[model samples]
Target: MRTAYCVDTVRAAERDLMARLPEGALMQRAAAGLAAACADLVGRVYGRRVVLLVGSGDNGGDALYAGARLARRGAGVTAVQLAPGRTHAGGLAALRRAGGRTVAPEDAAGPIRRADLVLDGIVGIGGRGGLREDAARLAALADGSRAAVVAVDLPSGVEADTGEVRGAAVRADLTVTFGTHKPGLLVDPAREYAGSVRLVDIGLDLPGEPDLEALQHADVTRLLPVPGAESDKYRRGVVGIAAGSARYPGAAVLAVAGALRGGAGAVRYVGPAGHAVLARYPETLVSDQGPERAGRVQAWVVGPGAGDDAGTVAQVLASDVPVLIDADGLRLADVGAVRGRTAPTLMTPHAGEAAALLGVSREEVEAGRLAAVRELAGRYGAAVLLKGATTVVAGAGGGGVVRVNPTGTAWLATAGSGDVLSGLSGSLLAAGLSAVDAGSVGAYLHGLAGRFAAVGAPVGAHEVAEAVAGAWRDVVRG
Candidate 1:
């Protein structure tokens, strides 16, 4: 698992590490790693034109010292002072002694424009909001140039804690982060600014749970349900899907498609679109009766295309089995019934549904995804899966690291995708994974399948459903 820490956690860790070490020990360790990454990025240090954006902090000192290293190796290195009078004195003197040159903010543009590489050290994690006027202009210049822009720690003008990118920000080809991964580097908004991240370990002891967590193939593999020789159809787990209406039969078909590949022994589908589901997948056990008479199931996935079916939502929620609520179910289900349930409840909602539940706008939920998901989980006292570019899964009652899915494509925004996700995750729940595990693993598979289905062009949601097994194989085989 790849973990991310917030700014405060990183600061606290850095302080603890710094206190035990000698003076300037931590800075030197960080600078050494930064210089090595720069050498690797440029492919060579000798005779290259390198421009460093220096500010008034340790980040600037890091860049200056790294520039000094490059200068001694026959590269023409220039340090541009963003804060002219307040630059690191020791770093500046070292750079000057090693044939490195210093330039003011006005004169810096020329070298930055023509340089082969640019290192952004204008702002560190402590700096909030966007870049200042002078820094923003330099950022723009670096972006427009052909230089391979590398940001130190994080991109200037991005919040390292919450990943909120305000005004102007530097977009880097690579961001060499010190110590551990920052929350901003792993999430969206600010994540987009950080092109490819390279972590440079400077040996800081960071204990305790991380602020955010992302699963790898191995993590998902361990969570996946694999049957033994003694396992039977019922023993392997059965997933019941209550979806689709007469008006929209495709929803049921899509959901069943996802459930079929979800490691479940059997898929029992109950809804008005039974014919549609059976036509597409003959293996499904179809039923037209209400959920109470739909036979036994280990878990239930409701909604999708069941338009305003309050009775069905209520019936499933009252069951003693795990339930996944999506689409119309998310809208029509009673909040009190969901909260009052003894069985585990997994609420899957896009920004719009989540906004409606919270009485806020879609923009608000999208802007603050972490906070919105946490609030939703706490409000309903159930596991909440907020689906979007960054699919976040939070367990019931909040207060833990929210799992963020790393694999996905923008093409996943297509219709019927959410239905597929709901069915797949519900099957995992039936297969004996907890709400959080089921949601995160299902999301990981669904995203990888979407990428496989779409490739470079647009593809149908059915293709995505078909590709789930390939994704499953890829994860397990790894």
Candidate 2:
């Protein structure tokens, strides 16, 4: 699993490491790695034009030292000084000694326009809100340029802790982060700004639990439920899906389709769309009765196209088994009842739904997804899966490390896709994973399946659901 630490944790680690190391040793190590990464990106660095946006922080020092290394290797490197007087004096002198020239911010446009590469060292990890007016202009110029932009640490103008890009920010083709991955580098919209991150370890040992964790293939494989030879249908666990309405029967079919492939022993579906579900998947245990009378099920998936079905939602929520609430069920479910449940509860909401639940605008949720997910989880006393560009799962009571799903394709954005996710996660819940694990693992598989199904083309939600088994097999094989 990939883990990310908050700024305070990272700073503490860095300070401790720096104290133990010789003066300037840590910076040199960082500079060397930065230079090496830059060399690899700008292949055949000799005679290439390199522009470094130097500021008044350690990030500027890193860029200057790296620029000096590049200059020694025949690149015509130039530093654009954002704060001339306050720049790292030693780094500036070192760059000058290595034949790098310096340019004022006012004189940077011409060089930036013709540069082969741009290093964004304008701000460090501690920078809050957005860039200053002068720095914003430089960021704008960098965006307008054709050069492959590489951000030092993280992209400038992003909230290091929250992943919120309030104002002008640098957009990099790659980001070379030091020590550990920052929470901003893993969460969006800061994640979006930091394209293709490359971690250049500076050897700081971070302590305690991470702010966020992202599951890899190995981790997901370990968590995947595999039945033994003696396992039976009931033993494997049954998932009950209480979804769909008379108006949207496809939601029921799609949900059942996902549940069937979700490693559950059996699927029991009870809703108005029983006929549609049975027509598509006869293996499903269909019922006309309410969720309370649907017999035994290890887990229940409520909502999807459950239009105005508050009664069923309440019935499912009252069950002692773990429950997953999604789509229309999210709307009908009671907060107090959800909080009072003794069993694990997982709530999956897109940015819009999350916004509504939080009594905020959709823009607020999308802009600060990490905060939104954590907040919702705390409010409901349930695990929250906030679905979007970067799907994040926060555990109940709001304070555990949030799990971020790294695998996904933009093509996964389609109708009924979330309904499929609800079923898949519900099945995992029945299979005995914790609410957070079920949500994260289900998201991982769902994302991989979307990638496999799309393969650069548009894909239907049903197609994504069909590809889950393939995703599962791939994980196991790896």
Candidate 3:
């Protein structure tokens, strides 16, 4: 797992390390890493023209010290101090000693335009709100530059904790973060500005759990359910789905279609569309007696074109197994009942449904996805997956970082795609993965399946569901 602590956690860790180490050691480590990354961008340190957009805090200190390192290596380094009076005294002195020229922000435009690289040190974790006038101007200047921009910590003007861009933010080609990743690095709004991220280890030991986490390939491998030699079909667990109706039987078939391809031993589907589901997937155990009589299942997936079938949704939610609520099921839910459920509950909603659940507008959820996911998890007391261009998975209990699905394409936005995801995640839950693991792993697999199904072209819901096994195989093989 690639863990990301919040700003406060990072500060605490930084303070502990700073207290034991010599003064300026941490900053030196940060500066060295920044300079090294810059060297790779320009291909050579010597003879390259480098511009540093210096601000008021240690962020500027980091850039100045890095500028000094480049100057020592024969690079033409120029420091454009936005707040000269507030700049780090030690860093400024070091830059001058290493032969770097200092220029005021007013005189920065010309040189910045002609430079080969621009280092943004206008803000760091301590920053609040957007850039100040001078910093914003410099950001705009850098934005128009031909140079490859590198952000010192995070791009200036983005909220470190929430990934919200307060107003205007610098868009960097690369961001070099210190100690651990911040939440903004993995989320949208801020993530959109942060082009690429590289972490610099400063040996700070963080306390408690991380505020955010991005799963790596190896972590996904460990979390995925793998059948053992001694494992039988019944041992693998079964998933029951309550979906579709007489009018929309395709939803039931598609949901069952995805469940069959999922790593479940068997799928028992109960709805009014039993015939349609069985016709498409003969292996599915189908019943028209509703979810109450669907027999035992390890997990239940409810909703997906369920229409106004309040009775069906109520019956499914009352079950002992973990339940995943989606589509129309989300509409018929009583927030209190969902919160009161004893079994693990997962809520999968697109922006519109998420907005309804939170009593906010769909635009609000889309505008601030990170905040929306956390709010929903906190409100409903369940694992929430807000599906969109960037799928966010947040645990109901506090203290876990949201996992952002980076593999989805707009092509996956077709009708009934979410139904497939609901089925896949429900199957994983039935296979005995925890709610959080089920949602995250399900998202990862769903994205891979979409990519495989699309293959750079448009794809229907059935094709995406059909490709799930191939995607699972690719992940296992890797």
Candidate 4:
């Protein structure tokens, strides 16, 4: 797993390590790593013109020390200090001794414009809101430059913990982060600013669980449900799907296509579109008796083009099995009934649906996705999966780490793709995983499948569903 901790946790870890080490030792280690990455980025350090955007804190000191290292290697380096009087005394002296000059903000435009590489150390992870006026001006200058930019820790003018871009920020070609990954580095719109990320170890030991996590192939393999020799179809678990309307029967076909490959033993389709489902997938067990009268199922997937059927949503919510709500079900389900459920409820909502549930505009949810998803989970007492370019999953309990899915392609924005995802996740719920696990793993597979299906062309929802087995095998074999 690729793990990320919030700013407070990283600060605590840094303090503990700094206490045991000698004075200035940690900064030296950080500077060494930064200098090396800068050297590689510029292709050569000798005779190269480098400019450092130095600020007030240790984040600036890191840039200054790194500049000093570059100066000693025959590079012409200059430091543009944002805070002249408050600059790190040790770092400033080192840079001057090594033949690097310090320039005021007024004289920085020429050097910044002519630089081979620009290092951004103006703001660190603890920075909040937007960039200050002078910093914003410097950011704009960098934005207009041709130099390859490298950011220290994270890009400026972004919420390091929330991935929110408040105002003007530096767009870097690469970011060199220390210790562990920050939440912003792994998410967007900050992630969009951070082109590529590389982590440097400074030996800060973090304790307990991380604040967020992104699962890799090894993690997905462990979560996959594999049938044993002793396991029968009934023992494996059954998934019941209540979906589709007379008006839109293609939804039932697409959802069934996903569930058939979702590792469930059997798929029981209970809805008005039974004929449409059987025509496409003859393997499905068709039923018109509603969810309650349908034979025993370990879990239920409701909504997904049921066309505003609140009665079907209420009936499924009253069941003893775990349930996943999507599409029309997200809008039509009773808030009281959902909050009172003893069984697990996983809700998958796009930005518009999430906005409706939270009583906010769609723009608000898009702007602060991390906060919105967590708030929805807290209010409804259910696991929530907010789908977009970055798919985030939040567990029912408030304040725990939210899982981010990092494997999707832009082609996943097509119609009926969400319906396929809902059915896939619900089937995993029947296969005995918790709501959080099912949602995250399902998203992981769904994304990889989309990539495989699209392969530089437009892929429909049914094609994405068909590629799930290939993604499953890739994870398991690796």
Q: Which candidate is the best by TM-score?
A: 2
The TM-scores of all predictions, comma-separated, are: 0.97, 0.99, 0.95, 0.97
- What TM-score would you give candidate 3 relative to the actual structure? 0.95
Expressed as tens digits, the lDDT of each residue in 1-478 for candidate 3 is: 7777789889988989999999999999999999998888789888999999988899999999999999999999899988879999998999999999989988999999999999999888878788888889999999998999999989999988888887878999999999898888877778888888999887989988787776656677888877899987778989999999887888888888878777889999999898888788889998888888878899999999899999988988888889999999999988888888999999999999999888999988876888899889998899999898778899885336788776666789999999999999999999999888898888888898999999899999999998888888887777
Pairs clashing within candidate 2: none
Model 2: worst 10 consecutive residues (lDDT sum): 178-187
lDDT of model 1 at position 284: 97
Best by lDDT: 2
Report the error of model 4 at residue 388, Å.
Answer: 1.0
Q: Can you give the lDDT of residue 377 in candidate 4?
A: 95
* Candidate 2 local lDDT, 117-182, one digit each (tens): 999999999999899999999989989999999999999999889999999999999999998888
Please give the lDDT score for candidate 3. Answer: 0.88
The C-alpha stretches of model 4 lying farther than 4 A from their native spots are none
Per-residue lDDT, model 3, residue 307, is 92
Candidate 1 per-residue lDDT, tens place, 402-438, comes to 8999998999999999999999999998999899999
Candidate 2 at 220: error in angstroms? Answer: 0.2
- Comparing 1 and 4 on lDDT, the stronger one: 1
Ranking by lDDT: 2, 1, 4, 3
Off by over 4 Å in 1: none
Clashing pairs in 1: none
